[model samples]
Target: MMVEIAIFFLLIFMIIGMLFVLEIENLLSAVVMMGAIGFGLSVIFLLLGAPDLAIVQIAVEVISVVILIRATIHRDIKERADESLSNISSIPLLVCIFFFFLMIYPALRLLPTFGEPVFLNFYSSSVYYLRDGFHLTGAPNIVSAIILDFRAYDTLGEAIVLFTSVIGALSILRYRNRKKEHNAS
Candidate 1:
């Protein structure tokens, strides 16, 4: 119950952060709010027992926020937002958003209740893994059996992707530093 309440509050925080990002006039402030929203989502993912997703979200959020802030830091973004144009565009955007919710409302209602098994009505391999992974793989831990035995290749792929991302980010940062040093000399 406490975990659910915390998730609910984090959801509310994320929504408010999103609204702030949309409405704030300052580019840097908007980027900060975006980071807050992303961090809130990571927290919610953690609370929901998906630490892998939470870690990925944190990494993506950090990199994107850094890039956005670097791009916008020297720009005069406030002067770029024309008030009259925004006023005119907001009406149609709101209308479109309303219609979008109307279209998706029925599908939302069809979703399973919170904390319920989403694949209960269908056959899912996850059910087999959860039930018999340890027995079939002769592993003491269910997670170990699932990852080491059943999904070894998938896990290897994910590790490779993460390694590539880290190397790419580091290269970009190093390039920026080298450019700065060259300019100084």
Candidate 2:
């Protein structure tokens, strides 16, 4: 019961942090708020018995903050007054928020209550994996077996995507450097 209440408060804090990030006019402040949101999410993950996910969330958040700082260090940190949405523009924003809640309401209703058993009908599948996963996949850990053996292709695709993004960023930086050199010469 106390754990659920803690998780609920953490979630509320995360939501508030996200809202502050979106509404803040200063880019650096927004980035800091984003870090706060990430930290809250990591705590929530820990509360949910997902230590691995919590660790990954913290690592990713730190790397993300570093990257964002490097990327925006040379850019304007303050939002321009002209970029702010006028009162008339808020009508569409409110409409979009309404539709977003409308779409999410049903999905939210389908979620089991906190601390309740989930996927009760899938117990057999879980048991089979727990009992035979090592023999079938030669992986010592059940989570490793499921991710590396059962979902190898999906994991490989995600790795490929990350690799491609890194390559793309390198290429863009290289091209920019060459352009700067040419202009300097």
Candidate 3:
């Protein structure tokens, strides 16, 4: 009961943080709100008994925050106001919110009730993996077995994508530097 309440509060915090991030005009405040959201998500993961996911979330949050701060250090943090919302403009926003709730209603109804068994069958794929992962993959950790053995190819593909993105970013920056130098000379 207490755990569920804590999780609910954490989820609320995350939602509020997301809303603040979207509405804030200051870039630094938005970044900080994003970090808060990430931290809340990590805590939720921990409460859900997924320590591996929590660790990854924390590391990603830290790295992303550092990169964002470094990238925006030279730029103006305050965003220029482009448009003002009038009373008439709020009607469309209200309509959008109504439609969003309408769209989500059915999905929400399909979700299983709290403290209820989601699946009828007890011997599921997840159970099988938990039982045999160590023997099959020789990995002591179930998360490691799932990622490094069961989904090794998928992991490798993700790593390749990340590597490509970093290389692309570096090349773009390098080209910009050379262009600047040529223009200066």
Candidate 4:
């Protein structure tokens, strides 16, 4: 009873959102509508019990809306947007778009719809792993073995990427502050 009502609501919002995205003339309006679509999808995910993904979708949707809002503040929006969406593309972008969608088509169609398995057999797999593997892997902790043996390089690279991103953000912020100070002086 409740599930059907939920689906009906989701479908209604999705239909409206799709129409909004398609019918909107302004780029900003379309961006906002796309965010709405993301939010709606996030709600659907939440209803389906994927809390992590719902959070990610909400965060991404917020960022997209904020970026679109920020981009409109300084630019000559009207003049830039006077060109039709078709006119906005160059040969390079068109080729890139063609290849990007072409790349995704096979993967998107063949990919399984994402969600957790209906049943989790924790007692079987987790029990076996706990009982075995100290001799084979020569590691005391299963967590340590998984991280150090299988994914050590991946973990190291991720840590390096995080460090690099933090440094890059700090550098960019300092540069912006200095530029502002210089201009103000």
TM-score of each model, paired residue for residue: 0.67, 0.80, 0.85, 0.45
Task: Show model 1 residue runs off by greater than 4 Å.
Answer: 76-79, 83-95, 120-123, 135-149, 155-185
* lDDT against the true structure, each candidate: 0.86, 0.85, 0.86, 0.74
Top of the candidates by TM-score: 3
Better of 2 and 3 by lDDT: 3
How well is each residue in 29-125 modelled by candidate 2, as lDDT tens digits?
8888888899889998998887878999999999999888887778876986466566458789899999999999999999987677675446666
Query: Pairing residues by index, what is the TM-score of model 4?
Result: 0.45
Model 1 agreement with the true structure over 33-91: per-residue lDDT tens digits: 99989999999989998787789899999999998999999986693455444356668
- CA deviation > 4 Å runs, candidate 4: 79-185
Q: State the lDDT of candidate 3 residue by residue for 95-168, as single tens digits.
A: 99999999999999998887675654487878888889988989999998988889999899999999999999
* lDDT for each residue of candidate 4 in 37-147, tens digit (9 for 90 to 100): 888889888887667678979997898789777776565344343445575547888899999999999998876544433233456654554466566578887656655
In candidate 4, clashing pairs total: 0
